[model samples]
Every structure is written in C-alpha cells, then in structure tokens.
Target: MEVKVPKEIRDYQESIFFGLSTRQFICSLLAVGVAVGLYFGLRPLIGSEEVGWMCILGAAPFAACGFFKYHGMTAEQAAWAWFKSEFLYPKKLVFKSDSLYFDAMKDAIAEGEKPPRKRKNHKPQPPTGKER
Candidate 1:
C-alpha cells in the first residue's frame, strides 16, 4: 500500500472526518448550523428560495474561514492583520535616510560650489619593455 506524504511536514493535517482536518470539520459544522438557523428563522418571513440564498450568504464566511489561507497565515490571522493595517495603523510609512556626508556638504552645495569630480586611483600606463 502506498501511503501519501506531504512535501512539507508542516502542511500535513490529520483528517478527523470526511477528509477534513479538525479545524475544517469544526468550521463546516458551524457553517451548517448557521445555514440551518438562517433557513428556519427566515423561511417564515421570506420565501424558501430567498431564505436559501440568505443561508448561503450567511454561511459562506464561516466556511471560508476554514478553507482560506494566505502567505501561510490562516483566515483569522490575515483578517486581524488587515484590520490592524487599515484601522489601528493607517498611515503610510516612508523611509528617509540621514546622510552625514550630504548634510556636511549641503552648505557648500547651496553656495554653488560643485563637488570635486571622482578620479580613478589606478590609471593604465604605457607598458614597460621589461617582462616579468
């Protein structure tokens, strides 16, 4: 018998039921519960067809949480990161470097003194007749 193995050991998740991990199974159960609740609660007020659509919409987020993964982060982690980036820290961070050389030369530059041109230390000279 050939046993399946994941390329990355960390990616391996033991299937608890119906080929779903424990977390996935739990989320699926929660989604089903929400869908059933929505269907029964809304069916009386709205028609069966409308309530069915509402159940799907209501349960989708719960189901997505189990399946969704981004950049190795779970849905909840990604959601929290997004919330922090958008609400808690919304300002754009720009990097500004402080150059001591530039700061020292600013006065001369403003006074219109052109910086000295860089020169190569080693210049090619005519080859000597003597060979090594």
Candidate 2:
C-alpha cells in the first residue's frame, strides 16, 4: 500500500528536511575546515614535523562527532539514540525510532497550526510520548 502524508505533515517534513540538510552540510564543512586548520596550525607547533598521524587521530574524532551529531542523525533521533546507547541497550533502536517519529509528527502538526494565543499557558508544550 502507498502511504501519503497530510498537507501539514508534508509541509513540515519538507521544511524540516531542508533545514536539517542545510545545517548538516554547513556543520560538515565547518568540521572539515577545523580539521584542516588544526593540521596547518599544528605545523608550527610540531615544527613542520610529519604530524599527519596526530592530525588524523585528533581530527578523526571531531569529524566523527560532527558527522554523527549533525549529518547522520536528526536532533531528536540523536538525543534519543544517545540516551539509549549510553543507558539502554538492545532496545535502543526501537525506542529511539518511535520517539523520533512521534516528535516529527508533532512538529508537523505544530507547524500547520495557526499562531497561538498571547496569553498565559498558551505556549505549546513540546511533543511527548506517542500523542503526536
């Protein structure tokens, strides 16, 4: 069966996808630039030494972190994954995906809604559980 997204979901998905992709691209570029800078900056410190190994070792982690942080994962997914991987194993993937999907749904709904009233307790709470 074919799955179709509602207009609001489609809009929110498109917006979020574009926003996330842009941020990931920029962050990846910045990470690479920082790595390059480290290589060059270390040249003076290491006295033109073949510190290629140092650069690789040090920058690799940063690059990995940046990739995992911004590119390979979404903000919600990453946070959930981190929580699961760090504290809860075996059920990590299951929980994270469910939570992320729920969050995405809520974001789509919120994006489609009219502006909230300017009154106390009017602020929308972030999505929680599976309500989205």
Candidate 3:
C-alpha cells in the first residue's frame, strides 16, 4: 500500500546540496567547525597534526550521524525521536513477575467461574441408537 506522507515531510527529505538536505548540510558544517575548533584548541597542549587528526576522527561520527535515515526519517530526526520515545511520555509497561502473577490469578478466577463455551465451529455429537 502506498502511504501518503505530508508535504512537509517530503520537503524535509529533499536533497538541496549535493545529496545532502539543508539540515544535513548545516550539520556537516557544524561538525567541521567543531573539528577545526578542537584542532586549534588542543594544538598547544598536543602536537598540531596529531590533535587535528584525532579531532577529525572524533568529529567524523557526529558528522555522519546526520547523513543516514531510519523509518523514512533523517538520522538526526530518528535519533531525536528515539530519545523522546525512550525518556518523554513513555508507554505503559508491566513487570514480568506482576504479569505472570496476574495471568495465573485471572486463570484461577476464570476456572472457578465457568467451563468452556460452545464454539460456532463445534459439531454436534452423533447418536449411537435411533437419533443420528
């Protein structure tokens, strides 16, 4: 089935620069900025090339984070969505012990109340004598 996505979502997914969307392009720029900043800041304490390389390596994952997608969502969007789902307004959850105990208690109560109900697919028993 073809799912109809909103125009806004489609627009957000469109590539504006090379293969990167505006958000992704901006994120890449920010990552480069952070790498440069780290290189410069740490050059005095460490060696220039070593620190620069380390900074680039470290910033690579953060930069690439915006380049992928999940469930038709951009990587950044997916990550943020996951964060929200995990921490903010989570769904109701039951503990294993509670669920097991509740299920057993429910079964006990149901057993005490009644026997099995006849199903629609149940066939009537055939008579052995006159009634067939």
Candidate 4:
C-alpha cells in the first residue's frame, strides 16, 4: 500500500481524528459546545428560530479561529499583529534627509558673501489730535 504525503512538508498536519488536526478538532469541539450552550441558554428567552441563528453566529468565530492560518501564523497571532499595527504601535514614517555638505558650504555661497544691508532708521511722528 502506498502512503500519501503532502508535496510540501511544511503543509503537512498530523491528523488526530476524522482527518482533522488536533487544533481543528479542539476548535470544532469548542464551537459545537458554544453553539449547543447558546441554543439552550437563549431558547427560553428567545424563540427557537432566533436561538438557532444566535447559536450559529456564536459558534462561527470559534470555528473560524481553528481554520484560519496565514503566513504560518494562527488566527490569534494574525489578530494580535493586526491590532498592534493598527492601534498599539502604528507608525507614520516621514523621510527627511539632511546634507552635511550643503550645511557646511552655506556660508561660502555667493548670497552669503554679500555684505549685510544697513537698515534706515526714522523717528516716529506725533499723531495730530484732530485726526479720527
């Protein structure tokens, strides 16, 4: 008998039960538990139809968490990274460059070589009392 293996070793996941990885199995179990709990807990307060919807909604996140993987990161890791990038340590990068040569040569430029201009000084005139 030939054993099937993933083409990429990194993509391989050991199946714990029913062809599900340990993480998937755990998350699926949790999702089912949540759905059942929500259905029972909300059934008395809300109608069966609404309770069924609520159970699905409540269980979706748990199921998604187990299946989600990106760039080798799990759902929580991706979420944390997103949170950090969006809020915790967001960066607004401004590229500013200073030239040492330009600074050093500024005083030696043609404009800098010109002599400073003298300012005209005039005494202020007294205002006429009749002027409105």
Candidate 5:
C-alpha cells in the first residue's frame, strides 16, 4: 500500500535524512582515518615486545570511543537509544516541522523589523597641527 505524507512532514523527513546521513558518512570516514593513523603512530612504540599486546588492547577501547563519539552516540548505549526514540523517529516529523516553521517565521519577522542600512561615517578630518 502507498503511504501519503504531508508536505511539511515530507520536507522535514528529507532534510533530516539528508543531514543525518551526510553527517554519519563523514564522521564514520573520519573515525576510520583517525583509528588507522593512531594505529600506525602507536605501532612503533608497541614494537614486538610483551607490552605490544597491552598497547593494542588499550587502543581498542579508544578507537571504539572515537567511533561512537563521531556518530554522536556517546559511550552510553542507553543515551543513544533515547536519542533514536526522542529525536530520530519518523513520528517526530510533526514536531520537527512545527519547530522549523516557527523558527523560520521568527527569522522572517525579525528581518522585516530591521532598520535600513545607513551610509558609513566618511566626513573629512580637520587639518592637523603638522599641516598647519
């Protein structure tokens, strides 16, 4: 069955999906690059010693944290769950559109009330003592 979406809902969904997907893609790429760079940089220090295993183990958590933070998920799975429920759900479209419209209207009103631009202060300065 085909589903119908209101214009506002459709617009909001498009905007949010594009924004979040772009952000997630960029952040995931960055996290991967950082993790790779960190591994290469730390490898010299780690070497083939017994401490190398410890270093590798320590780096794993750091990489995981970086990945989570890049995705705006944080270290807390509960918080991420809450975020998906409260902010990212499809049903939140109504509230998002209302908020987006309210903000745009407020900005339009503010712009309308602004004063017109005035000319810059360009009056000539009086002659200095040195010139006199």
Candidate 6:
C-alpha cells in the first residue's frame, strides 16, 4: 500500500523541468534542432569549423529566447518589443536642441583657452554651535 500527499502551492510559477517552463523547453528544443540541422546541412559544403559557427549563429536567437527572461516577459517577446520600439519607431526623434556649453567649450579650445570647469555646489554653513 502507498499514500501520496499533495504538495503545497507556491505563489510563483514553477518550472516543468530543470528550471525551464513549457515554452522555454519548446524554445530550447527548437534552438537545438535549428543548430544541429544547420550544422549537418552546411557540413558538406563548408568546413566543419565554419558549420559549427553557423550552427551557433543560427541557434543563438532561440537559445536567448529559451534561456533568458526580461521584466517578466519571455526573451523573444521582449526582443520583438525592443525591435519595434527601436527600428519601427525610434525614441531619439524628439527635437531637442544641443546644449551651447559644449559648443562654447569647443570655441574656447579653438582659441587656445582651457574649457571652463563646472564647480560643485557646496555652500559653507554658518558657524554651527555643535562641533564635529
């Protein structure tokens, strides 16, 4: 006779195997398959060393997706979001004018004068009754 006790529930999700969730497992498999396929397919045409590198390049993206996480999102999702934000709609398009301080510094340098240095804002306190 055998008895089984139910395990306690955790607040966070647990991995199905080796710290990899189902999606991660699938991603890892896909990455490995792609790498192996590429390596084998390219081996006859190119050197084995080159094929190995090609395998690495082909598998790196899915490996990243499988093995990495970002801000609670899967790596592939984060990567897509980043690609869209960076390439489709860049964040640097805002029309902000450059600061004239650097230009002034450059002009001063051209005129053979040293650039003005910024001073720290440390004001001396009036005589405190308590001594350090």
lDDT of the candidates, in the order given: 0.93, 0.63, 0.79, 0.91, 0.58, 0.82
lDDT of 1 by residue, 69-120 (tens): 9999999999999999999989988988699988988999999998887987
Residues 44-105, model 6: lDDT tens digits: 99998899899999998887777686777777788899999989988666776587887658
Candidates ranked by TM-score, best first? 1, 4, 6, 3, 2, 5
* Tens digit per residue, CA lDDT, model 4, 27-118: 99999999999988998898999999999999999999999999999999999999999999999999875988667667766466754569
Better of 1 and 3 by TM-score: 1
Model 2 Cα lDDT, one tens digit per residue, 1-132: 998778765334332344555545555666677768878888878754466776666666545553464545656678888788788885434433557656757866677865345776678887888884
lDDT string for model 5 (1-132, tens) is 998778766334233344554444455556556556656667777655534555556556545553365343455675677788888984634533557656757866677765346889999998787972
- What's the ranking of the predictions by lDDT, best on top? 1, 4, 6, 3, 2, 5
Find the candidate with the highest TM-score and give its number. 1
Q: Kindly report which residue stretches of model 1 are placed more than 4 angstroms away from their true locations once superposed.
A: 89-92, 108-114, 119-132
lDDT of 2 at 68: 60
Runs with alpha carbons beyond 4 Å of true place in candidate 5: 1-20, 47-132
Task: Give the candidate number with the greatest lDDT.
Answer: 1
The model with the greater TM-score, 3 or 4, is 4
Q: Over the full model, what C-alpha lDDT does candidate 5 score relative to the true structure?
A: 0.58
Clashing pairs in 3: none
Clashing pairs in 1: none
- RMSD to native for every prediction? 3.5, 24.9, 8.1, 17.1, 23.5, 10.1
For candidate 5, the TM-score is 0.28
Global fold similarity of model 6 (TM-score): 0.52
TM-score of each: 0.77, 0.33, 0.51, 0.70, 0.28, 0.52
